[model samples]
Target: MKSSILASAAILAASLEPVAALSEPLQNILINTDRSPIYRYPTDVTRGIIPIPVHSHNDYWRDVPFYTALSAGCISIEADVFLFNDTLYVGHEESALTKERTLQSLYIEPLMSVLKKTNPKSPFVSGPTRHGVFDASSGQTLYLWIDVKNNGEKAWPHIIKALQPLRDANYLTKVQNNETFVPGPVTVIGTGGTPLSQVVSAADRDYFYDGPLKDLTGFTSLVSPIASTSLMEVVGDIKSDSENPLNPTQLEAIRKQIKAAKDKSIGVRYWETPGWPIRLRNELWRMLWKEGVALLNADDVNAAKEYF
Candidate 1:
């Protein structure tokens, strides 16, 4: 009897060992004194914050909101690329292009510096490291959404060639000419006049595609669509007028679109919504969240962060 009792106790103890090992106390325990909260959020999770890239119009240096948004953990940022004379500048429109604030000066240089201090081998870094710089690890990547404001035909090759160095070094992602190239750790989202069938085919070869459901349906109707092996990112570019924050019909349309995309188990994003007004943000967030929209694009990161 004593032997049997001891044997049962040992088995019970063994069973509990795994659970005990897995359990961690939910209390504060400092690992390092000078830790940054950059990686506080998990990358796999969908609460990614994306800031609109600063342009020459905004005093990029004095843009406190933009920097604050980035420092506070915006996972993605956009920059409009235009070749002026021989240099690439970040500006929303061609009219705003200038020589002083080139893309490298405004964004690339600063980004490269930050990356060097964080991830020295980051394809963005150029020269030797500065002494006594913080050896920080690169946290979640920033999606350098290069919005090509130029004609698709004229800009494709030039942009591709210019990005070669970054592409080769595995820092740039190209989203043009209907080919989604995911070379290295960088993900390029192509956005040219490529047929959906061609985009879908390339996606099968391990590329990401962004499209609207309406457009995709039209593509499928033409051909026996292959099982979409690549990830699908949906966008709802909702329009707003002064009469209503967003027209009732427009809101309903967005809802239907979101539903259709979610039904197919694809990630969704909405753009061109109103600015960071509380009522508008809340309404959009509630509606989009209900339809299972995965990401929210905001003009102001702070407003979006509050809603999320």
Candidate 2:
């Protein structure tokens, strides 16, 4: 098995050799069921990280959150945040929140550790080399899509404060004088009612806005690095026949939205796509992939990684 969990079913299936004699490292992904928080394989160093364009939707819900998607080469990950009592708790809703599971614990702290590993302090380099999350492509900016599940106007300041760890380390991408976007280890994007007014108003801000893909006419890359829209909103319920791959109207709608986002030099991501009728879902994935969408929004990182 691949060092990453379900990293490559294709590789596992194509090896053709007998499975009984597979090496320990080869068997790690296939048989390793050690789910204890402390259970980390020795092979992680060699396995390392690869950056893929796929976005890990609801990333905190995964078995290991950010690490799981990173293991599978997903460069983008999201968290639904609800701020309360001066702490940003991560959960799908308030009911699911736990004091133990905070934005800092689940994301910020872990990412700081990952960045620490990648961007090692050394005499070899003159200063801090802003290496990104994945070791494979250390210079590639990892997108941290923060969805404001609560009141953005109230929670945003706390959210910015929560980013101090990254900011202090100089790991966050920042804008200089509202014109130049200096890419760094992580690019923080605000989505899901995350106050565009606040984002645009900041003349010197590390975070950016997530614009609507359907209408990005007024926006620019300086503010929104990525323009996003709901897939269901863009193309109606996906019903693909094997013979007829796409309804012309739906296909046209997709092209228009993609073009709209691309015109502003921003990447496009379609969230809330179809899930059931697995065939239709796969078809949509393929469609998005083929159309050259910047990042494919996904819940199944393993399948998405394999698809690419």
Which one is best on TM-score? 2
Model 2 segments beyond 4 Å from truth?
Answer: 1-48, 240-245
Which regions of candidate 1 are displaced past 4 Å? 1-69, 121-139, 172-186, 190-210, 218-252, 262-265
lDDT (tens digit, per residue) of candidate 1 on 1-308: 99999999999999878554322442223343226466453222223333322211122323542245465455445556665555566566677677876555665555544544343433555853332111222323354444555553454445445555444444543333443323332333333232334435443332233555544464321121111111113233443334344456656666676566555555455554455456665676566566555555555555555554
In candidate 2, position 212 carries an lDDT of: 82
lDDT of 1 at 20: 44
In model 1, what are the clashing residue pairs, if there are any? Answer: 175-189, 175-190, 176-190
Clash totals, every prediction: 3, 1
